[model samples]
Target: MYSRIGLTGDVMLGRLVDQYHQQRPVVAVWGDLLDQLRALDGLFINLECCLSNRGEPWQRTQRAFHFRADPDWAVPALERAGVDCCALANNHILDFEEEALRDTLDHLDARNIAYAGAGRTRAEAFEPALVTVNELDVAFVSFTDNTPEYAATETSPGTAYVEIDIGDEETRAAVQETLNRAREHDPDLVIASLHWGPNMVEEPPDTFQKFGRWLIDEGVDIIHGHSAHIFQGIEVYRGRPILYDTGDFVDDYAVDERLRNDRSFLFEVVVSPTGDLSELRLQPTEIHDRSVHEADDEAAKWSRGRMRDLSTPFGTSFERDGEQLVVDFNS
Candidate 1:
């Protein structure tokens, strides 16, 4: 827990099949992100893919969404980028299968970068990762309400999910239970990261609106979500904030048609004492080199305008700072 918790969203360590790691590899691509984000206290993002060294071929389902990263480059990249914790509650965390999941856990452990939202046991999967920053204790829990045919197992690791969907009794109860546990931990702050929403849809389902408000009422300090691969609105209910979708933070690439023209971003949240959100911001990033890049002047402001417009429904405001989308919800 920091005096001001800086939260970001969705870092998918992926190597596009077409742009497969070759000369200017994926590992080289992360250098800039690492340099840019190496100083924030309590930095976090959703772990959007599995990291493995085993040379497994790409696997995909009928709908076709699978992503894996070479742990060798992935782990160090986060470390270099000053990322302290990761939310293992996204659709692709198990892309390569069970063994890959295990390897990912081991890799995370070796790096000493804490993670939550999924684990090798039911209790572990249900628990939050307690991260202490500058002596402040912060707890993080992650989940995915989307992603088909995948559920965390007592003997396996995967994203923590809402069970069925938002508003379902089982899902709300699980969320409530997790919230209760997070409260018991007495964290200075709590970050509830989620992976949800339709892939290319910009608007969140009505169920999610209710869910966000409910979580805020139940004492969640922050509610951050992704999976849409694009930016969505931000809401502030009872003074707590919810960022619905923060399009791809770092993924080598995606073939989604919408992503091509999508105006997306990465948020940096600063929550203060007394449970108030002081800073809700983002830096507009473009997909390139198997990573994200900051756009130049004109392009930067244009991108910010697009994101600002998207967040309007929820009352969150944004502006462009060079290539950064600086947001202020309380202002």
Candidate 2:
């Protein structure tokens, strides 16, 4: 048996999505991608913002941006899209502070949505969110290397974090220990969803690559990385897939033409029951009118070329299969 998993980058249902919901249901924004998403055995996305109407913004210092959504609106949107699991380990998960984070957790639980990374305590934040699909136990572990201030403490509610600075031994040890504990669950497949790296950069840093390899060495079957709003290269380390950065999946933010942050992909990974990867494909996507749609021909060509350039260095290439981009893993 094989499980087909659908993965996406930062999905912020607040702001524009909230405003758009006033006109129509949130699932309408998914456009033609909705049916494709529904066919997957599992779909995991980075919940980039809190889902609560309460809690004050962090006031110690001014933040460039903060995001939140009314649970009444956000919950239904997620349900309509058939989102099975979400990674709550990003920098913005606690934008509205502890109360909102707690509410977000409660809201997801009430809807039977599983989330990993952020929780009311340190242990909860590090624990894997497990779900059985196709009789295979799939585990998701999330962490952010971006904002330490949002990190969970022994008693506070926050996100799970791994220090980004390569030389930070203490933080590295903490991340390794968390992964080790997650491995003890012995799931059929483990996905390490890491919210790391800088935004808008095309290539990842050496430390980021090394850290991804380290996680794979520690038994993580997949490395789902985000934060760079643009897609990065894909590295298959020892047959396990490492999505260096998936780019922005759905957001209402203004796009920078130069960065091409709007260019994105819906990554699909097929894994056998024995935990071996069988196929990897990419659905070229673009953000339009606050919804996700298949990329146009011109946009598709550009995205395919960009991915080719980025993945060439790692010995990975892609072939255009109709509208989708298929990874040439056998190459």
Candidate 3:
């Protein structure tokens, strides 16, 4: 009855990454990590780009970049990795506007890939994607605090947007409503996939930490957080884990020499037979030539050290299990 769920930060297949796909096979994007991803019972990632060929860049507001990939290759790339679900409530989903967003939805639907956070309407945007793995029913809901202009209206198409201020009663009420909707499915576990906060930061603000704890109090089993380009620390509250920031998984963005945005982890959560989270294992990974792969020895060492320093503040400890870092919750 145990289930292994794999989670990653952002998976953006657009711009330069898309160009590389033309020269190489779609599966090349995963490099040697393809087999590792497929080993999990379920995998969820924040799909950080729109898969479409239509629509112009969003001109409704001042935007610096727009990411859109051809569905022909992008959808196959996702399928190749055995992506069970995608969190589409990111800042880049509507980079090419509503037309591209609709196309993204259609492409995922054709592949039977469950996605949440963005949709044709506000109500649809807030809906959850329920999945079953090893008889464990998991509910996933996505939300982003970025790009307020991309927020969906009653009749428009956009993402599930919410401000992350815990002090705001309105924000709390909205989250409660979304939780209520997700509870309707009677899921064994509820995962809140959030694309919040600014990018390139090292740690979450105090408000975000409070908010993450509050979400757990409100019945969320896990908080999958990202947006900051660098991975942050892990905090376990009330027997649930909150991944503050997972950093970039697969992207072509320029590397920040010091921050090393390319360094990340493939997080695997082991859910016990009793439906409680048992262990968290992190397999170090690094992006190279627009593809993701297992981190080399040096990169893996750096990741292990950095994670130890970052997580120690929360009183979290880990044991090196070969190439992977293991955190046992039952300890």
Candidate 4:
């Protein structure tokens, strides 16, 4: 059988969501998936929010969001469902400050749940995450555009973020850190799970695409990005599939009537022992109650049709935003 890997967009487990009257019911929805797919070997999610029951508000920002959990029911709810790996490279991971971030990491470690993205120091931040399956080693690296001053440093704790300036030498060096790890392991595959761009842009800008290609040229096997909150489109570049945004995987963002009804896809990637992504499968889905559900035949057809349009302008091709289709680049 081929290797089965599940890649989700973003997830936030915290107080604000659990208080919803139907949290338990939502848990039941995911529980079924865990039982069915646990034996598949790998499950990965972008942990969009931080979970902690500690620390003072680090920033004096008048308006901010922090995701807190009761600490008791949260991990069990997640782990019992068989989520093996988490990407902590999103903007919200540092909402609770360093202390809470540490606590969250402590809990995940105690549960034997693997995580990447933020770390106590620069070395820790850019270190590649590892998952061994069927004797193949897979490395995961995560980054974010949301962190303000909570970015990685040689001496402090924080998330790994990219910097584009020569003056910001620290952030530039962090990239080298991850690059070195990528070369050292030379695993069966390497995935850079970066949280970037605006919340609902239909596609990546020129700069984003440029960075994607740069990372690919740097020996990355897959460039998986999120933070658009909505599914944008996917592109097959140089024999590798680049998913611009996978949308929100799981959360209580269900009330957005528009997003709740968008046609989404669960990216299923099949890899060979040599780390080649030999197959790409889109598990068409529909968003309901802020969660994802497998689509019936009719919905599947509709989703496939939309995706075909979305994928058309991927390679140097882009459509201007608004009422009509205007191609700006040659495909």
Considering every candidate listed, which one attains the maximal lDDT? 3
TM-score of 1: 0.87
- RMSD for all candidates, in order, please: 3.0, 1.5, 0.8, 5.7
lDDT per residue as tens, model 2, 1-331: 7788999988987877777865786577677799889889889999999999999987756678888887787788788788889999998988888999999999999999999999999889988898777877888889898788888899998888878654689767777777677667778888889899777888989988888888887788889999988889998898777899999988898898877888889999987787677878998899988888889989888888888788888888677789887865445
Candidate 2's error at 189, in angstroms? Answer: 0.5
Q: Where in model 3 is the C-alpha error above 4 Å?
A: none
- Residue 143, candidate 2: how far off, in angstroms? 0.7
CA displacement after TM-score superposition, residue 109 of candidate 4 (Å): 1.0
Candidate 3 local lDDT, 263-300, one digit each (tens): 99999999986679999999999999899999999999
Task: Please list all clashing residue pairs in model 1, or write none if there are none.
Answer: 1-136, 282-325
Task: Give one digit per residue, the lDDT tens place, for model 1 in 261-286.
Answer: 33355567766655456766676666
Q: Candidate 1 — which residues are off by over 4 angstroms?
A: 1-4, 17-27, 55-63, 163-166, 254-263, 273-275, 319-330
Task: Looking at model 3, report the run of 10 residues with the lowest lDDT sum.
Answer: 166-175
Per-candidate TM equals 0.87, 0.96, 0.98, 0.84
Deviating ranges (above 4 Å) for candidate 2? 165-167, 328-331
Candidate 2, position 297, lDDT: 88
